[model samples]
Target chain A: MKVLVIGAAGMVGRKLTAALLAAGQVGGQPIESLMLADIVAPETPAASLPIDTIATDLSEPGSAASLLQARPDLIFHLAAIVSGEAEADFEKGYRINLDGTRHLFEAIRLSAQLYRPRVVFTSSIAVFGEPLPAVIGDSQDHTPLTSYGTQKAICELLLADYSRRGFLDGVGIRLPTIAVRPGKPNKAASGFFSGIIREPLAGMEAILPVDDSVRHWFASPRAAVGFLLHAAQMDTAPLGQRRNLTMPGLSVTVAEQIAALRRVAGPAATQLIRRQPDEVIAKIVAGWPQAFDAQRASALGFRAETSFDEIIRIHIEDELPPVQP
Target chain B: MKVLVIGAAGMVGRKLTAALLAAGQVGGQPIESLMLADIVAPETPAASLPIDTIATDLSEPGSAASLLQARPDLIFHLAAIVSGEAEADFEKGYRINLDGTRHLFEAIRLSAQLYRPRVVFTSSIAVFGEPLPAVIGDSQDHTPLTSYGTQKAICELLLADYSRRGFLDGVGIRLPTIAVRPGKPNKAASGFFSGIIREPLAGMEAILPVDDSVRHWFASPRAAVGFLLHAAQMDTAPLGQRRNLTMPGLSVTVAEQIAALRRVAGPAATQLIRRQPDEVIAKIVAGWPQAFDAQRASALGFRAETSFDEIIRIHIEDELPPVQP
Candidate 1:
């Protein structure tokens, strides 16, 4: 199977590409070739299979269509301006998040005569806003407070519409916040969710921007990549009319995160976390969903870590070296 | 207040226009001028104030901007291809329903410097699809099964986003199926909902396409106009981030409708209805929402007929002349 990964340079995209390469196949088809694209050229991985990398803005009129010249059997669209940036730059956010997704979908639709590729789109939990249910179910309405969330919700609608019209076979997965995100601190309001764990594990101080009582949903980076693969191969007929599903995630409060950190890295490491609440971040995080039923995803065989401790272990094994005695 | 009605020639648009003229005000501001637009020039109604009529497609590149030349303070966007036509013509549906709405919104956003208009958008209950709850609430997620519904859902998202960004003050009202419709039966699968009552009341036979047990939500043309007028004047602060709302409507089964018809128009009038099963239409109607909680719209003072009999009476009072014995 020939696969194309848009936003291939990003964290999840890179992880997904690596997983795809390691598996050597997608949906039981041997990988013949792989194409990676982003706003910046993605690094071509060392693999026996043919791999091509391109730097292009999919929102550009013909940029997305040009990528379809090869007509890969599977496409993973993970491209998006993160919440903070999208909320700050309205035009850029809509341009990249909303218009870019549409451009790619439109390109696939226009090329449907040749092939109908299985397209997996990455949506976000941000699609849910304030006035959330105590436990949000897959059936809850999307009332995004931020522009980025709005963009994601709109794209989910488009994905369903395009798929229903038979322009493409599409599946949209709303990913939970990836705990212990292996990177420098970012500007996302929820950045602290990962920052506190990642920094403390690295023997560095991390700021706790909100009260430990603030709870939210999460999954490991590995689970996210798994969702992409499963979505690519799943029998979407069972999904019926609703093409979007909220992926299974571990729901935990920040205090539980600290307790998990203490169990994993000792009290010394946990002490590296400092509480200095930032009201702006606190206000933003307050509106986020704390938990979801995610019954549909679980029933579909999609699984995630049941506890924050397992999440921490996964992060340590995946990103950290053995701790010194 | 100056007002612009984009679909001024349609049923709801004409009634709303007439209401505005009769009241001579919206939100307590006297009407200075009114602009009406449609694919065909809307007949300029005689009024004490200026009424400009123009035939134009809002989807055209500059067409929407041209309508904004006058920069009316209150804008009513009700232009759309009916459900049946939209379902039949895929490209036309997206072009008109999706692109047309975006053009108008973009036009408003671009012209934000001139003034922030109160935009009253006419959405529909079609935004809800199957797998619905027994009573869909304001928070029900949009999972439209039809292209027309998908377009409306997407537009609702855009409206909320635009309103959040302070580009325009928008209020989207999802109207119920209007009953006792004052027109010939069209191709909408739901057309028979009105046709059965309208045709029979006019002393003509009407076909019942589905079982009498088939239930759905509804409001009268007069009540629909009432929703528009109320939505235009209402304070949106209570709505917070969710700008779109499912307007309160009566939920009734077809059997109840027949009973109500008998109460208002006599048992002889009810006998004018004949049964004819249409599997295609039955399947279509089967997917529609039978009821809604609509608590938010009700709390905000947007009212509808409490019973189906009142709805029939409304049609008689507004559209039909005095019934002769």
Candidate 2:
């Protein structure tokens, strides 16, 4: 199977690509070749794994067509402007996240005579925002607070329509916050989720933005990869007309996360935490859905980390420096 | 009141314009000027009614910005590719409906640096389809069956977000099938709603694709005009964050419509109807929402014709020829 991974160089994109390569085969078919794309030139492994990397900005006109010329059998569209940037630069957000996705879908649709690609789009829990209840159901309305969420929701709509029309077989997975992400905190509002765990493990202080009682949905990075792989191979028939699914996730409060942190790293890890009451961040976080039933997704074989402790351990093994920072 | 009517050549657009002119004002402000636009140049009344007609295809880049240059106080967007055409030419649908609406919304958002325009967009019941209950309630999930419905749903999402952001005072009214539309039978699948009455009154045979037991939602041209005018003037404070509303409509079966036609135009109107089942068309009609509990719209003072008989009478008074063939 010829596979294409868009946004191949990003963190999750990198892991998903590695998993795809490691599996080496899907549906009893060994991967013949892989085409990877990113705005920055992606670095392919030196070994002859039959991978080609291309650097191009998807927002540019004709970029999607150029990418579609390769005719990838399986396309994973993971490219998007991140949340903070999307909210800050309004035009760029709509241009890249919304318009760029549309162009890519259009390109593949217009070229179906030669290639019919099955696409996997990475949507986010961002698609669900403020006015959230304690537990979100599968059919909760998408009331996205951020521009990024709005854009993602729009893309999900597009993906479903495109799939319905038989232009493509597509699946959109609304990923939960990947806890124990095993990296320095990025600009995401929920970065603190990782910061508290990652920094504390490295014997550094990490500030908690909200109270310990604050809760949100999470999944380990490994579980997220599992979701991507499963979505790539699963039978989409039972998904019926709608192709978007909220992936199974673990719900945890800050106190539970800290307890898990202490369990994995001992008393020293708990000592590295600082509480900073940031009302603005707290208010923003408050609106996010705390948990999801994910009943449909789990029934369809999607799974997540069982506990925050398990997630933290996975992060240490995968991301911690061999030598202390 | 200065108002701009996009898709001014459409049936609803013409009726809305006439209503505005007849009202002589909006929100207690006198009608000063109207700017009309469409792909085909509109032939608005030439008797110095203070109207400016511009023929422009909004799908063209920069068209929206150019149109907004007029800086009208109110904007009524009633433009879209028909559902069947949209389903057939997916790209064309997105280009005209989704992208076109986005460009116009963006134009209005940017134009607000100097002037904030009040926008009334004509959404359709097509936004909801398939897996619907016998009577769809307000706030039901949108599961559109066609590409056109998807585009409309996507646009509705944008409308809500933009309104929340205070870009424009946006109001999206989801209209029901308009009965006795004044025109030749168009390609719309729901054209049967108008067809049964139109062709019969014109001394021609009209085919009904579904059984007379099939029911659907509808409003008259006059009621549609009322919806536009009300949406233009009503207090939107109660709408809060949600700007899209399902307008009130009369739910009636084909048999009921036939009864109303008989009452108004005698048995000849009923006799002209021919039953010829086409599975293709019947299948399409089955998925649409048959009843809507439009409480929000009703509370907001938007109403439809109470009876299909009144709807038929209005069609006769305004559309039918004085001398029958």
lDDT of each: 0.92, 0.87
| lDDT (tens digit, per residue) of candidate 2 on B158-187 | 987788777888899999998988888877
DockQ, per-model, please?
Answer: 0.90, 0.51
What is candidate 2's TM-score for chain A?
A: 0.96
- The TM-score each candidate achieves on chain A is 0.98, 0.96
Candidate 1, CAPRI quality class derived from DockQ: high
Clash list (residue pairs), candidate 2: none
Residue B28 alpha-carbon offset, candidate 2, angstroms: 0.7
Residues A27-114, model 2: lDDT tens digits: 5778888988998988896445688899988889898898877687888999998998988888999989998898898888888665
TM-score of each: 0.98, 0.93
* Model 1 spans with C-alpha error above 4 angstroms: A322-325, B323-325
Q: How would you encode candidate 1's per-residue C-alpha lDDT over B264-293 as one tens digit per residue?
A: 989999899999999999998999999999
Worst 10 residues of 1 chain A by lDDT: A109-118
Cα error of candidate 1 at position A29, Å:
1.2
DockQ of 1: 0.90
RMSD of each: 1.4, 2.8
TM-score of each model's chain B: 0.98, 0.96
Off by over 4 Å in 2: A46-48, A321-325, B46-48, B199-205, B262-268, B320-325
